[model samples]
Target: MIDTRRLRTLRAVADHRTVTAAAAALHLTPSAVSQQLVALEHEVGHRLLERDGRGVRLTAVGRILLGHTNEVLAQLERAGADIAAYTAGTAGEVKVASFATAIGLVVAPAMDTLRDKEPGIQVRVLDAEGDQSLTMVLDGAVDVAVAVEYRGAPGEDDLRLFRIPLYSEPFDIVLPRDHPLAAVPDHDGEAAPAPERDAEMPPTPEHDARTAPVDTSPASTHDPRALPVDTPPTPERDTRTLPVDTPPTPERDTRTLPVDTPPTSERGTRTLSVADLSGEIWIGPYPGNPCHDVIALACEHAGFTPEFAHSSDDFSAVVALAAAGAGVAMVPRLALRGTDLSGVVIRPVPGPKRRVFAAVRRGAERHPLLIPLLHALQDAATALRQAPSM
Candidate 1:
């Protein structure tokens, strides 16, 4: 085998054209350079240099070897530059895998910044779900991967990957503006009364006692025991043109009213079961996808199996489906922000949360640029968490 050390020495000597000069360049004694050259010639079974007086010149075979040596040296220099560029975080490529939700939310935005900041750096994003992303990262198919863990689902704890929190959003029930619940009065941002119910009327008590028509007189002027005792008979009048002593009847509204609550609410001895959504189709990514697993398990725990009505690698497409009423989908909150989803609603699955991490090849940690990239990701994660809309 041709030794790299010997090749380097030979190439150096060829460039400088003298063993003494090559020794000086390599920080070796002249005797040491001569000895290495002899060993190299023995290994190759060919004389690489011929003595020309006190100096040396390349033999015909040595000339050919020198040409090849120059090519090899050039290749090594290029390789070194590539490594240096990668170390400086100014060049090279990174393969990243994540789900559609995160691709739109975290990865895409971060990539935008990276592109603007480092033109030479290339990032390739793959649309992979949670479990798939993890598998890819672990298997060395991807440099970095983002996966989700539900609020309580089992997941990786300790690994070579650098874990970071991207974002967290509260789940909310989505309803159309014309929904009955939409019309319900809101008191301090909270649901008040059902829209179909009659407007509330505070009770107004009637005057319980009334005194007969009497002349105005000072009550203090007359003593109780001395007042006239005889009382006249009650006056009566026609219903239209006269007054009567009878009490007036209260007026009743004649408009028919709808039931305030659903009949299911009024039923007795019934248990509230998970909604029967067998007829409702579910839409999400594939099985190995993190978001897919989250949605599937959430639905399963909720007593229903989700039907994947549409499968797409594009996360935007998944969200569009949910917004279009095609189906419900579990997605990262960041991706859904500022998106105009007409009827889509976001709800939290009563399950575990997906955790995302930064990963690299085991020995690649020593690379200089890795640390900066790691810090950038950490800072980005913090910024994401603090951002209002993320």
Candidate 2:
């Protein structure tokens, strides 16, 4: 009998194309990954891998086994789902993996809905990028993955996954508050984020000087990755703290759009287009992030490639860099929440929305723990749809 563990190792090897990468994903040493592959080869009586330049490639037989491996793993998921359904495990824990932006965008709201509706069910969330989360879902490392569309991943119609649409959000341009396009009249230089969610930047002379700090919030979450960005508080800025406990609402828009009062001068007439930004220094998501792909493709489609001068996956850092004139950035609307946007301006752009979705193994949606969770996620997405974004 083929060891499923070895089969999973083989699948990881195939997916990452390197022993080092596969081992890192599996939390094993490269020597151990190599040993397992050797053991599996001995058991199957065929050469499963070969060297190519600096990397490894699957042998023909290895590819054939991978096909079976997918089916086998998927069937195992089906069995687990059916068993959970049979046992009526509705109150069991559901593990979720999601990108940081999606966590703020939809998952946090979903968790709230689940908590109110199904008090007994437990939900655990892990922050990961789209590609990493998708792999976690496939490997049974997590019950659900909230992610953006990534290259070379299974699609909606793929036989081994069940996808639930979450939300589609546009990428808004982040420009310095002093940019030429921001010279509009009437409205004061207010940040584009919703008023209730605005974070006060306590004068961080140290944090401010860095074009892009590792983290950018003095009131940062307990997440270890979020370092403190504190500077001495200034007297000129309105130091009043925004209410933290108020729930979000669509009717409470504080943005002073030209339509409300009308722009008097020709200063507010400039419009935004991808082609209009061809020569600007771009601040973008780090490489391998799904948002990076969106920005890169949008620029390419616009007939020019942007030269990214600063990069960060954290939306706060990206906005901070943009605020400091490092470059302009493209950020999803939801991600702008809780970020310091005091020195930034937003000009809405078109198309190329970053669509978020919930994914499970092809047949695992039937799992009792997953049913309420999926419904809760969809419900949260519906609420987000009803809410307005700038």
Candidate 3:
């Protein structure tokens, strides 16, 4: 067996044309380089070099061995490069579990970015609820889970998983386009029509303030937190396991109520209190969905209990119902961005917001395959924050 280290020394000596020069290149003494060449000749049973005056020159057999050494060294360099790239998280398939609209707003955009930036990474997306994605990550079923800040998700300090907060989005109220509040002045507390926007176009904060997503950008001056974006004001949720069950919040009365009469104080505003809607019918998410607890909790905090008269996990369906005048619905602003709002109006309050984040197993956050994907997901989230809802 030939020693690779000796072969490298032989190559360096050949190129440098002298053992002393090769020693300098290899950071070794001239005597050390000579010893390695001698060891190489012994390994192959050939006289690899001979003294040609003051300098050393390769023998016929030495030339033959040098050629093979060149090939071997080239391959070794190639192997080194490939291993480096593999460890850098620049190439591989990453499985991601996310809800649908996030697939559109965050996942899809992230996919485009990955395609351009790290084509070696293939991202497989699963359409899942926030809770489902959280479980998938913990069970090692997926490389990452893009989930909402729901009731059962692991906390940032949870030992079982690592969480990366990507962005926060406000929940918007869905109302029939003709709903009296739609005619009330917008969030500026003045009567005005919001500028229309296509789902693909970026939206301004002024429009989102009326009935869409609030800009959560670091550069944005709008203070979304100033509004109550969470229910229960300041409650702690246990996050050690999926589907955490706490004390039951009082069930909201979801029965049909006549909202036919516009408020006598029909002054338009950007924010609404859950108490104000206690008398109106409500459409909410079903129990298994991540958004369910948030909606229930937010209302409970506002001194009222609200429930789902109509429950569905699909925000599009929830919006459709609200458009049909079935009932009012609470929707994450991102979910509303891509849905048809022809007959619906969103009512945004200074209240509850859903936090979007990416999760990976305890130590997997640093996995090469996950690094780029996580970055792409985060960038997508930041872009979504700048985008307004319908």
Candidate 4:
């Protein structure tokens, strides 16, 4: 193969069309340029130049090599331009893999900033989860993956992995307006179960499923009792024969007034607790879906195993299910944007979240634009984390 430097010399000679001129362009002697060109010709196994008076002219083979060399040189120059632009934080394309939440709450906003400020740099986004995104980055499928890392999650920093700390979103519990709990007090000492009427409750089945209207009324927020179903009294047993050793009881005075009975509290009007919701239907992205971790945590946090009524990967489906009272679901704040789920409520949960990270191939540390993008991501993450509404 021809040495790169020798190729450079040949290209210069071709461009100048004279040994002396080419040597001057390359800061080399005419003899040195001729020698390098000769060496390149030998490596290609053919004569690259034709004899002419004073200087030399390119042969057909020489022209072909020059064509290829020109392309290579152009590519190198483009790469250099990309490098300069990246270092200045103003050019090159950034390939990114982002989770649904990050795409909206973080990536979208960052994209606007990148477009306005660094017009020369283009950004491409792929919607993906943290694990898959990281894998894609490590395999060179993406330049950077916006991954989450919950507290106590694993790490890859020692393997050339880097990360930016992004914002943390607290969970919320969604409830209807007339929910018995709404009538109850909040975390503050104030009384809950805000005084509301049955009209605020979700439309109760006069008993049909499909025609259900928007349940403007909230379910009781506090522990509400289930309406009791009358059970048939057990058949009374007949004891016709008395055993010979049976003892008799003493009789009481016939006319004594019966003690006043204590009045009973209303059972069906109380708020339903988590345990009372065992049979409630639920909705989610999919079975065992990672995005639903917070939903599961919320259910477990609320002291019940969530009864999922339907499953789908589409965010819209989850929202739809929640709208129909199929069951409550956990959704990224970004995914919830612009969606009107009039009856669905957002509730906060404690100690529940997902974690993510930024990943790239093992040897990509030296990539010309990779470093710049990584730094930008880190800075953006810091700003996002410190911003309000996290």
Best by lDDT: 2
Assess every candidate by TM-score. 0.44, 0.73, 0.59, 0.48
Answer with 2 or 4, whichever has the higher TM-score.
Answer: 2
Q: How would you encode candidate 3's per-residue C-alpha lDDT over 186-276 as one tens digit per residue? A: 5455653322334322324333342223332343222111221113324333221121112212121111111212222222324566666
CA lDDT of each prediction against the hidden true structure: 0.48, 0.67, 0.64, 0.50
Candidate 4 per-residue C-alpha lDDT over 156-252 given as tens digits, one digit per residue, 9 for 90 to 100: 4323233433433332334444444434444454543321222112222231110111112342221111111123213232111111122222121
Q: In model 4, where do residues sit more than 4 Å from their true spots?
A: 1-91, 150-160, 176-183, 187-280, 297-304, 314-316, 333-335, 362-368, 378-390
Candidate 2: list runs displaced more than 4 Å. 28-32, 183-270, 338-342, 388-390
Q: Which prediction has the highest TM-score against the true structure?
A: 2
Model 1, span 1-390: residue lDDT tens? 787677778866865678997887677898988888899899889999998887789999998887777556444533553477456655677778876665665677667767676666677889875565654653446766656654333232322233333333321222233333333333344433221111111111321000001112233221211111113222332111111122222111101111111112111101112243344566666766555665566567777787777886455677666556566455543444555544433322222334455544332333334433433454455445433322
Model 1 residue 26 lDDT? 71
* Model 2 lDDT tens row, 1-390: 888899989988887889998898888999999999999999899999999777899999998988888778766766777677678666778899998766875788888888887887899999998488888886668989998875566786565567765656566677887776555332344323311224321113222111111111242122211111223224432111111223223332211111211111222222367887889999988779988988888999999999998878888999889889888888875677667776876655665557677888765765667777776776666555444232
lDDT of 1 at 39: 91
RMSD in Å for all candidates? 33.4, 14.7, 23.0, 28.9
Q: In model 3, which regions exceed 4 Å deviation? A: 1-89, 178-180, 183-269, 387-390
Alpha carbon deviation, residue 84, candidate 2 (Å): 1.7
Selected candidate, larger lDDT, 3 vs 4: 3
Q: Which whole-number lDDT from 0 to 100 does residue 172 have in model 2? A: 66
